[model samples]
Target: MTYKGDVTVGGPADVHELTDLMISKVAVGPMDNNAYLLRCRATGEQLLIDAANDAATLLTLIGDDGIGAVLTTHRHGDHWQALAEVVAATGARTYAGREDAEGIPVATDAALDDGDTVRVGQVELTARHLVGHTPGSIALVYDDPHGHPHVFTGDCLFPGGVGNTFDDATAFARLIDDVETKIFGALPDETWVYPGHGKDTTLGAERPHLAEWRARGW
Candidate 1:
């Protein structure tokens, strides 16, 4: 079915567009987790990232296109409250980082490793394992043919700093290093970041504050 109206934050919001792909975001559940739906404009195939709480809302977002796959960024309960329901409803394949797959309520059909690529129709999203928030926490990177990259950082990197490390100093360092090299170091300033919660931010806006995050040691 044709998706009516525009996408919004609490509803469905059009995040951005690649050559043949359109990214949409919807915030759901008590924690206000952001669930992202990436649709291939050419084929109508769709992929969802972080199918958090409120299965009804997610199902509505899934709509007639259905889903080709569901990629769980981490095993956090808040991130996958609707995982089993969505997978059961659509029969879509499931994928998650190898280290964290087992914790998920549903079995992962494929294991995601750093540098792995997941495809939705013709669009390809590269998985980057950014361990810290969770041992298998990951961020998916989508590179637009004509623009800077866009990343779905599950619970990893956010606008202010990396996701909470649960007071683990070692995990905090690991997250900081990966964000610096794999993210801030590799991509241009224009890269758009859609986090697990709250507003969207660009790498350019958060780049200068890296030092502050490091010094504060969060």
Candidate 2:
């Protein structure tokens, strides 16, 4: 059960230490939703992002390690259905956008807007509202000890595409703008982009495609 390198689940544990961040991905269910367990090597503090669809598997991944916080990108069941169980098991505070907070079991602890920081041991994640897939979808950004900025882009921005738009077309369009002009455009080119459901890409890699995305009116 111990993952060693860059894991893609249902496969061997491809573990690797990225500076102070020990990363592992647990793909739960048929959707292949990736739930990330990020442990800060400096303090051994754990942060769980996107609980996916299987609570039992998530509990096993978390184990006895201290989970300081659990963050959900949106209200989609595949992304956060196991949140309540994780919270109960670890007592880890949950964070989500205020608009979708009601969907979560614990709503009081939910975050309301962009720029709110949630601390998990030594790691402090700044929440950025990247609404599109949902009215309250968000992304988390933080700097690793090596000073490499990492963004856990929930479902907003993927490797080469964007999240599905079922909410409001106008709002979804605006959300894409915010991601381009704010999230992706605002971060340093070297920032590592870990998305909710795809291969990892960087801010620099996604920058060039912004114009093409805009041309398609997405």
Candidate 1 lDDT tens digits, 1-218: 33322334466555565678887788886888889889999899999999988888988988987999999999999999999999999999999999999899899999999999999998888999898899998899998886789898998888788999999999999999998999899899999898998778889999999999999988
**Candidate 2 residue lDDT tens string, 1-218:** 43332445464323436667776677777677778887877889988888876788887777787688888888877787787778888898787888778776655376658888877666677888876778888888887667768888888888776777764678668877879866777788888877787567788888888888766765
lDDT of predicted model 2: 0.76
Candidate 2 residue pairs in clash (backbone atoms < 3 Å): 4-15, 5-14, 5-15, 5-16, 6-14
- Segments in model 2 whose C-alpha atoms lie over 4 Å from true places: 1-9, 12-16, 105-108
lDDT score for candidate 1 against the true structure = 0.88
Considering summed lDDT, which 10 consecutive residues are worst modelled in model 2?
A: 4-13
RMSD to truth, every model: 3.1, 2.9
lDDT of each: 0.88, 0.76
| lDDT, residue 61, model 1 | 82
